[model samples]
Target: MDQGTSKGVSRTDSVDNGEGTVSKALQGSRKKKRDKVSAYERAKKVYEEIQEEKRKERRLRKQEREQRQIATEKYEKTKRKANKMFRKRSKKGQPNLGAQVEILLEKIQQKMK
Candidate 1:
């Protein structure tokens, strides 16, 4: 075996062709490039997964908002109908059985709360 040194670099084993030479330093740069591409691919996959999870959460929130709106509309329609029925009987100046029942039921519900 032969050893040589040149300008702060050391070579352990090397072969020289008629035109050029091969060295470990040149191969190390190619390995570094391969590592960079792999790291980029892994990061891209993680970002996509995060976006998908956010989309699912948004969909769930939208459904909850729609359900709440539907429930509010139903309660308001029922209350409005009950009020209209009571007003009609009061305008006619007669106490009707149906209006009395509705008033009693509303009072009972308020007391329970």
Candidate 2:
């Protein structure tokens, strides 16, 4: 019974002539090699993940900027409304005591000078 190349292994490695010597070559070569398509797929997957993270960060920053603009607008609107109310009250015979005190104090200081 003559043994030829057995499943890609050389014939010399498979046949033993009563001796116990075995070759260690080609022992790790039986595993399938990594193809180019699989490596490309992995790199593409990693790139897409990084792009998604960047998009999420941009979305969060955009939301924060919009919230800050809305808060500033609300503050400006409240200030305008308060000033309008104060002017209306003063026109309706309601004098601000703090303004009268400041005017009297300035008059007294000018007289002393």
Candidate 3:
């Protein structure tokens, strides 16, 4: 058989010629050559990664700040409600201490639960 142009032989098909396989040169030629990365490209990639990390951290911090703001707003709303309740006057024109203490106790119990 003619080794150079065998019938139905493909480049991927290895041929044994009693010495060894003859596809090493073909395989080497088929492999893609890798180009070395330049220092500027490496630095640019590192800088981009650092910037991405900073953006992620900033987003996390913004979310946390928003959460804290929401908690503060809720606390302020409850505080205003409590102050309004304490400022209620009776027929005697005095602060409703008894009702305020009852409301405070209920809030404490709810927090404990």
lDDT of 1 by residue, 1-113 (tens): 33556654455554344456656566567568877757778899999999999999999999999999999999999788777776664557876678768778987998999
| Model 1 ranges with Cα > 4 A deviation | 1-37, 90-97, 102-113
Q: State each model's C-alpha RMSD to the native.
A: 7.7, 11.2, 7.0
| lDDT for 33 (candidate 2) | 44
lDDT of 2 by residue, 45-108 (tens): 9999999999999999999999999999998986675555445536568866665565567558
* Candidate 3 or 2, higher lDDT: 3
* Candidate 2 colliding pairs: none
How many clashes would you count in candidate 2?
0
Off by over 4 Å in 3: 1-34
Rank all candidate structures by their lDDT, best first, as comma-separated numbers.
3, 1, 2
Per-residue accuracy of model 3 over 24-97 as CA lDDT, tens digit each:
56545545333557789999999999999999999999999999999999999988888888888899998888
Which is better, 1 or 2, measured by lDDT?
1
Q: Report the Cα lDDT for residue 21, model 1.
A: 61
Using lDDT as the measure, the top candidate is 3
- Global CA lDDT computed for model 3: 0.83
Q: How do all models score by TM-score? A: 0.52, 0.45, 0.66
Q: What is the C-alpha lDDT of each candidate?
A: 0.76, 0.68, 0.83
